[model samples]
Target: MLQIYNTLSRSKQLFKPIVPGKVKMYVCGMTVYDFCHIGHARVMIVFDMVVRWLRASGYEVIYVRNITDIDDKIINRAIENGEPISALTKRFIDAMHADSDELGLMHPDQEPRATDYIAKMQGMIGKLIENELAYQADDGDVNFAVRLFPNYGSLSGKSLDELNAGERVVISGGKRDPLDFALWKSAKPEEPVDTRWKSPWGEGRPGWHIECSAMSCELLGEHFDIHGGGADLQFPHHENEIAQSEGALYGKDRKLEDAPFVNYWMHNGHIRVNEEKMSKSLGNFFLIRDVLKSFDPEVLRFFMLKAHYRSPINYSDAQLEEARAGLVRLYTALAQVTLSQAVKAELTDLQNPWVMRFTQAMNDDFNTPEAIAVLFDLASEVNRTQGDEKLVLASTLQSLGGVLNFLQRDPTSFLQSGTKDEEGLCPAMIDEQIAARVAAKNAKDFAQADSIRKALLAQGIVLEDKPGGITEWRRA
Candidate 1:
């Protein structure tokens, strides 16, 4: 049985799906105005690990990560570039997929785009207005009545008074309360024609909070097993979702306990730079593609998992290089072993102590750090053993890593393909150099062999001489 930390409850609880043997999960996905950054990468990898674990545990998982394809950012970027909103969003969407593919992310079962569910959003907003939970402001914008919803700040654990005190300069639109958020934004005269929709609230578009509420309810019903996002969304965005969704579901008589929108609320912590939150405004955020230029995609994935999901992970080149070294060690153990039929059969023996420990670690709040430690333990055993048993250990290591989408690449290729200077010295060139080194050693020319090793090492290539005069190399 898996236990996950529910942000709403503020403690770890046993996971029980609303439907037995099945899970319905909704995660707030990317706002595709630009390329995804490392912060976004954490969200993608964290939930992906959760879904993979659920399915591996014999539960059918229905994962839905919604895309915010029609947000204010998307609209502004389209106008700035003088392109259609669709064109701007499509490029980022494609880029997101490419980034996920490189990071070895499993696609969500359903990726509901915000634009695709405009009608549903409008219908839900109408329900709110009919119930008096939402009202069309004097400016024609529709805003949720936060005061009417008694449990408005429950998710964020802040009272209305606290929120008011902490509030920054409020946007003085037509909102009755400073804390009240938009359900529908009235269109502006200067806005592009494509940005507006013919809504009941006039020619306007759905607000960011309303889009998720509508799409999640329409796709996964009014209530679902898990709702997750980054910690930054815990305040207004997710809190607003809970208010609007429940308000529409149970009307003005809604109580927090009466009808819940989500059972378990999970939020992964942020990625920081030098203990500061990574953000574009700070100029500290690193794009996924930018980081990929230097580090392997899997290395980035591993770096994110090195910390517990709820803990803030600091990003640095040194940290990534350390993660790369750790990954190299795991791959090295599996290099010589093959997944034979007998080895595959051995994996089914779940009673194996190492497998049991791995499962236990994963079950305890998806403790990937401990689970990853188990992999290192297994790797050590694989290194110390030989023959058929070693093959079984190697196969077991790969199988467990597959659950987290790691260690599946061909070991030899993974090891050799990570050379820092791919263009300067291709794999063939490295092999030729290694061949020369070997020939020098065979001729007892120690000086020449040492010189060759030094040159490769200077180029960020590490060479390991095996017992049988074989040399293995990887990027440093």
Candidate 2:
């Protein structure tokens, strides 16, 4: 009983998979021309959260996030770097995986590269041509006839007239209509030879829109449960995907086009930095690896989840520091319990009131911000109690966090591993300082003990002196 905000429907609806207990989802993944930015990171984390929740709800999920390994950007970057397209794409794909690993992302069940599905794309394009939904342009490129598809702008909620008026589509010389998009692009003489595939429409490559249509249909059938991507893709990319997929493949007679292409469409919002869109032209673009340099990977993940997936998240040092502090507070509560108990414990009692509330929040459109509030409340309870109740509360906190792939680290290690500061105190140094402070307090040198506490505080570390002279320290 989960309600999801479907972009196509423009409202929250109950999620019902095509198959009873199975979910087949396709998310448009990274276009590997360069390192993934914070925008790309949001797409990665948002869908990851979705997949985690779906599986936790007892559904078998086959998540497929496609990689655009062969795109115009990839080709241009390869040419600029004076390397083969394969070499350029390989480096970026590896970098993307490293970032994914650091962010604790689950690998998609199938990551189909666009290059491998050229035959499928060609087949779909040929079918469209046969149905008269597509035509080969005078320039040897095949373009989808948008006018023939009556529901072309349904996903984006814009009519052909509205799209034509608002959109500034550059009219290609051979295109019959400005709004028509290419299904197959004829190769250019200057482009890489390997980038071109021999198709019925001469030596060219699949257009950006057709790639997803072909790959998703080939892997997940003509229709699937969910299709997700960034909001920017809603207009031409996803709208065109719906057009081509349904225009050629779906429906009984193909002309009526009555079948749905994708059941639910989910789009994660954009990432803005300091109230502006994150872009290279604006000088606020941050690569995922670069942000991971300053903040812990968990901190970055938490930052993205702090806001609802559909809401635009503001990225700044202050926001990240706040996220870091909030995550530290959650981990600090877990640190109160023994590491073995915290890690090994499971939520056997789903009927617990807190669990019920958490499930309610998560079921309502993956309301992570609300679900996370339950964690904070649980942590507060864990900190105030002891013995059996505290054990249960702490275990519940860890179990709930694990549903979102959070709170899996050893609490002590997680608390101590602060941000990457070259001049800041390391764990050994902090421990040495704490030992000195403890020794001074034991020897009745109150002034020296006070001095050590003040010094550590000035270095962005907080110390809590517990009974029996145990001092716990964490980055402030």
Candidate 3:
């Protein structure tokens, strides 16, 4: 049985789909005001791997990640750029798809947009209002009453008595409590785009939280298998979603016995740059495009998989280089295995131990880093054996490794694609220069060669020359 870590229960659980072979999952998607970033990529690719593994294990998965196309952030960004909100949002959505595809994340089973589900949003809010789960304010805004839902803090583990609304919260009159969130917002008279709809209350737009609840329920169902997002969403965003979705389920006429929202919850940890949480104030935030321009997108994806999904991944130039090298090694190692001589399309018994190890590690809760370690071990073993003796096993190893999506390329081609440009100080190149300098020393052109190697050393490559006229180089 496949096992997965569920944030809701705070434990690793056997993953038996509620509908047997079918999986219904909803993940919070991009806010669409800015270009996607590495932070966004982590959640995308993590869930992508989850789906990949599930499918590989024989489960049919239906994944939905909703795009929050309309939000305060989008409106403000559009105004600043002097462009229509729709144009700005469309640009971002397209950019998101480009970067996401570049990183090799499979598109979600359904990519729901908030703007497309306005009517469903209104109907859900109407239900909340009718059930006393929501209320309308004097200013034509609707807010979910915090005190009305006894399970309000179940997701975030905070009580109404302790939680306070801050920056992301909107100030409004209809709210009975400060902690209550908007279900609908009254459009500003000069708000550029028509961020309003003719609701029973008046012409206004749906709030951020309601969009996910309405859209996910409308597309996926009233209750789904899993809901996932960044760790940051554990607060008001996801917490409120659980409240609304769960409340709707509990209030169902059918009186379902299970939790109303989701049977599972998965969260990825934060990402940091220079040991600091990436933030606008620090001037260190990197867009996904920006990083992709500097390094292979797979390098970033590999770097992410290097750490457990639940651990904060600290990123730096050194770390990226390490990830690049590590990936190249795995790729190269797999490529070195000879498989063409196989008489039949059969996997060797040698493939079993590694598969069991990899499966056990992953089944322990998608331990990718650990599973990759198992892969490296298997690669080493594969390298130790060659020829037809390892043929069938080698093919099986190659095929299964390909399923991980990180081991398809030949290590040599992937590394020597001439991806190394003047950018990214490569230590291997630096070392080669050092070896050249050593060669100059052997030729007694000490001064010239010393200068040459010194110039190379400054660039961070190290070289070692053997007495037998052999040289090996590595990045310093």
Candidate 4:
């Protein structure tokens, strides 16, 4: 049985789906105003890993990651670029998909966009207003009454007093309480006409928090198994989601325990750079495509899994190079053996020790680092064994890696891809250099052979001289 770390409970608990053998999960996805950064990649890949593992454990999973296509950011970017909101959002949405594909992410079962659910959001807001949990302010904005919801800060583990103390004083905008947040935002006169929708609160758009509440409940039902996003969203965004969703479901008479909105809350940690959080203001933030220019997509995926999902991962060229080398070693082991039909047929035996260990690690809160350790162990065994036994070990390695969406490529293709370095020597050129070195060694020109090795190593290429005078190389 799998145990997951529920952020709401602040501890690991046994995972029990609301429906037996089925899981319905909602994750807050990208706000598509620009290209996805490494932070966004972590959310997509982390949840992708979770959904994959759940299905692998024999549960049917309905994974929905919503897209925020109609947000303030989108509107502003569109206005700045003098394009329609649809045009701006579509470009980034397509870019997101391309980035996801490059990172080997599986498409969510349902990707609900915010614009399509305006009617549902309006209906939700109206219910809250009728129940007196929400009110239309003098500015025409509808705001959720945080004071009426007693458990408003439960998700973030902060009391209302604490939140209020931390909040900056600003014009209340007709809100009865300072902590109250928008359910619907009244449109500004300068905003595009298409961005506004006719609602009970006048022509305006749904607030960011309300969009997820409406979409998640409408698609996944009033309650679901899991709700997840980055650690940054735990406060304000997800906390508000909890208050709004549950408040809407139970009305003014609602207690915190009246009904559960999400059984488990999970959050993946942030991506840091040089021990500082990666952000645009700091100038250390990296776009997915920018990183892909120097490393293979799978290398980036492998780098992420190398750390526990809940722990902060630092991004550096050296760290990525290390991940690349690790991948090369795993693929190298696969290259030495053939997974014949006979060997592959035997891979269905889940009772195999290596598979059992991998499953155990994954079951313990998706401990991918431990699971990957098992792959390295299996790879070692493959290198040490021979004939049919080696083939079996290699097949097991591939099968276990497939569970985590790794190592399914042809080993040769992966090894020769050369880390996507545009200016670096190609695989064929490296091979030619290796051939020349081999010839130089055979002709007794030891100095020439040494010079070739040093030249290649200078370009971040590492060459390994194996038994029987065989030479192999990989990007360092």
On TM-score, the candidate that comes out on top is 2
* Candidate 1: tens digits of C-alpha lDDT, residues 1-476: 78999988889999999999999999999999999999999999999999988888889999999999887778889989999998999999999999999888999999999999999999999999998999888998898888998778888788888875122113556988888888888999978999989976689998889999999999999989999999988888888899899989887687536758999999999999999999988999999888888888899989998789999998999999898888888998988676645344233356988888888899999999999999999999999999888988888898888888889888878877662434656778888999999999899999999999999999878898878767888766
Q: What lDDT is reached at residue 105 by model 4?
A: 91
Tens digits of per-residue lDDT for model 4, 1-476: 79999998899999999999999999999999999999999999899999999988889999999999998878999999999998999999999999999898999999999999999999999888888899888988888888898777877787888885222123455788888888998999999997999986789999889999999999999989999999888888888898889888887677645658899999999899989998877988999999999888888999999999999999998999899889988999998876655255233356788877888899999999999999999999999999888888898888888888889998878877775756889888999999999999999999999999999999878888878878878765
Reference-based TM-score of each model: 0.94, 0.96, 0.86, 0.93
Q: Report the error of model 2 at residue 313, Å.
A: 0.5
Q: Global lDDT of each model? A: 0.87, 0.88, 0.76, 0.88
Per TM-score, what order, best first?
2, 1, 4, 3
Rate residue 131 of model 2 by lDDT: 80
**Residue-level lDDT tens digits of model 3 in 1-476:** 66778877678888877798999988899899988878898889888888888787677889899999888888888888999878999999999999998897889989988999999988888888877788888777888887887777766666778777844667666677888889999888878755667888788888999999998899888878888898888878888888777665564232435646888888999889978887667877778888887678778888888788888988787898898778766665555554444333222233567667777777777888888887677667666786764565556556666656776565444655423454645556555666677778788998988688666556554444546765544343
TM-score of candidate 4 to 2 decimals: 0.93
lDDT of 2 by residue, 47-166 (tens): 999999999888999999999988777888899999999998889999999999989899999999999999999999988998888989899889888888877888888888888612
> Model 4, residue 163: what's the lDDT?
80
Mind sharing the TM-score for model 1?
A: 0.94
* TM-score of candidate 3 on Cα atoms, chains taken together: 0.86
